[model samples]
Target chain A: MHIPSWLLTFCEYLEQTASLVVLLPLGLAFWRWPRLPKTMRLMTVYLVFTELVLLASSLVELYRPAWSYGIWHFFTLVQTLLFFRIYYLTLSSPAVRLLIQFAAVGFTVFAFLDSLYLEGLQQVNSYTHVAQSALLIGLALLYFEQLLNELHITRLEQDPLFLVSTAVVLYFSGTVLLYVFVNKLSAPADYASHQVIYTLNSMVNLVQYLLFALAFWYAGRTLPSQSRP
Target chain B: MNSWLLPVMLATPVLLLLALGIVGFVLRYQRRLLRQQEQLRQVRDASQQQALEAALLAQEDERRRIAADLHDGVGTTLAIAKLHLSTLGQPNLTEEATALLDQAIGEVRRISRNLLPAALQKFGLPFALDALARTVPADGPTHVIIEQRGQPRRLDPKRELIVFRVVQELLGNGLRHAHAETIEVSVDFGPDYLSLQYRDNGVGFDPAAGDLPPAPGTRSGLGLTNLRSRVAVLHGTLRHDSAPGAGSKVWISFPIPYLPADQKPALTTSV
Candidate 1:
């Protein structure tokens, strides 16, 4: 395939820019440090972890490019754990919280197994991405159900957890398919030519971060809400 | 474009739209549930108010019947017996018997009046309240003062009874429980509202702890429950402030329905 150089450069810049965009939300999360609730504080931790992972991955890519996959494999598992904790705090149902616990355990084991045996550390972890998307999307659906059942949050848009859930649902659903074909897309022959494909992940990353920024902003200000029993 | 790329592009929007559609449906469904919950609350309140009104009206009817029995049936019989005793020939014996009869008649009259305030039906709430105050011992430890303000127009008959009962209960409570030295009761007839204020300098119970009414199944609890029901039925507001050592103050206001000037009564001001 004769991929254009300009097009390839554009995709590279876009991906790098998307990677760095985590700073915007990280800054907002720090600005509202004192008032962030437990769930939001967890989210801030997730943001910080993401930025660190991205930086370290880049550093490792320079000296030992193959080891970068291991860092990402670890990132995938931790991100799911954090999201599970966030949902656990916001949700009221004992049954759902129990489900989250079970799912968290199940996902941890699956992700490790997939990295060690199924996908290996050499290739993109498409299996882990797909599984993470499915799990988070399911959690997001449960959260939306919680919102309806509780009827406590009068303003859905202003609720930080709700915004975060919406973002999770949007990002995961929008990018799941692209991730499914990622291994084939990243084949060595087509890796340089098919840089445009990864741009989809960047676009969704943009949406996800903006939503997170909004979530952090709302967390800083006190909005009318009731504590879930 | 590769065969896999075409399917990914086509399916991504469908999946995104599916998620969006679910979110939108939830938003709409939640709003509807909220609306339904609000309507259910309003309905519950309305039915509760109606039940209270019916019970109160039935209570008043029973009181009226008992008063009539005391005044017409028992009181008349006692008076006739007193008249016959005075006709006895022995002067000393007649005098003693006649005095005892007089005491009996007076006690019956007092009981009858308490059961049903004739002044309340004939005169109005202010006259009835005045009569209520005079029933308390003037030289006793508790001294009650009644003050009426604004142009005292007549209210609905049932409303007048409620106002009178509220004052009666307050006075009764002051004498029985409050142990106050001075109790002041004020009624204001505003242009569109009727306000009642009662203040007592006594060993007050804590309103914050809900000791004024106490808990259910107690006498005070029943009294407060009844008082609250009456106030709620009229769509009125009730406020009570008190502490262990500090005095007690209660303020109640109701939206008044005014009567024409020609319908006003010409009752004397005497307590």
Candidate 2:
């Protein structure tokens, strides 16, 4: 793949901008408000970790070749782990904590095998991507059930749970559509399809970040103010 | 993984997910705050109603105490005075002197009975109501009847007192204001409900009129409003049905639980 100099600069700029825009606020939230809900804390940590991975990926491509593959594998493993956690919290009943433990062990074993066997790296990556996407879609469906009779406007007026649930649905749907159509339409001869897929993916990313911020704000200010120790 | 492609893809989704999570948290927090506010409002309303009822009950207790003191202490002293005066007078004493002592005794007795009816404390509601029925003038065109349909049960003293007082106040108002000749008091005891109905044959007034009577002694310039307040606290419904020259009927229905301890009277026996 022949990369233009301008496109490289743009990618680097995007990397720095995303780190500042998303990670900084999340970092501050975790530091100042240590008493945030477990769900929210998990999400914030996930955000900061992802941002650092992306930064490392960009830094590896720009300045460090020998270490790039190792960093990618490490971040990919982290991404899979975080996705599982999000799915577990959003989908499973609180009483079913045991299932999450089983999932963690399963994913850890899979990640170790994928890292050790470099010959099957692409296959492992593709498998993890599909599994992660399936889990998110499943989670989104579970939350949609939580909001079965719930009207979006009614929730916007009264309930923050409804708002969070709706956001999750939108973000999950966006990712599903983007990924399913990404390779099929974006062949080398057809640059237009590739650009469209990337644009749609970026838009989905933008909406999801905004929604996450809203969820955090609601959690911090509107939730029951039992003086968190 | 293309070094550039992997990070770009990962970065975009992560940022978007964070945004969605943030929004969810804010909305949830707002809902919680609103719920707490509504709960606080309900608590305040309930406390206010309770406070008003408490103050009214205290006032009634004070009035009952004062009425008792006058009847017992003052009536005793006056009787003793009458006895002494009679002893001091011999056969030689003038007719006017004896008549004066007798008149003084009658006045004292009337004052004591009016202050607190003896029937109320001794015989319960039915007997007291019969006494009230007798007080109405016989010459009036309207006839008054007091009837009990089912076996009567002894209510808790607190509940019985309120029912009796309300009935008294309602009847008194009818006599003074309704100009009705015939008044009927009927008590019906069903499986779950106890109903008291007072119907008069006078020119009825509009219910929407601002001058409608309040609680029981309120119309009598003493305790009607307080009586109504007490009934409301007992979770009973008091309703008024009236129109011009149509007569007035007041119905009070209460769900007083039937306990084994409640004494059931044999039947409707006249006072």
Best by TM-score: 1
- What's model 1's lDDT at A78? 96
Model 1 lDDT tens row, B164-254:
8887877787777777899999999999999989898887775545455454322232345567777877899998877766778888999
Tens digits of lDDT, candidate 2, B1-271: 2323444455546655654565566457546654665588689867876886677556556656666676577756766766776778674664566577567667766655655566665666567767877776676765778787676656655555666767777776777777777888898866766788989878776665545554432232223355457567667888777877788888888887653445743333221
What DockQ does predicted model 1 obtain? 0.47
Per-residue accuracy of model 1 over A1-229 as CA lDDT, tens digit each: 3557887788889888887787888999999999999999999999989889988998999999989889999999999999999999888899989999999999999998999999998877789899999999998989889888888776788888888998899899998888788777666666652565777778778888988999999996767754542
lDDT (C-alpha) at residue B138 in model 1? 93
What is candidate 2's local distance difference test score? 0.60
Candidate 1: the clashing residue pairs are none
Give me the candidate number with maximum lDDT.
Answer: 1
Model 1 chain B: which ten-residue window has the lowest total lDDT? B215-224
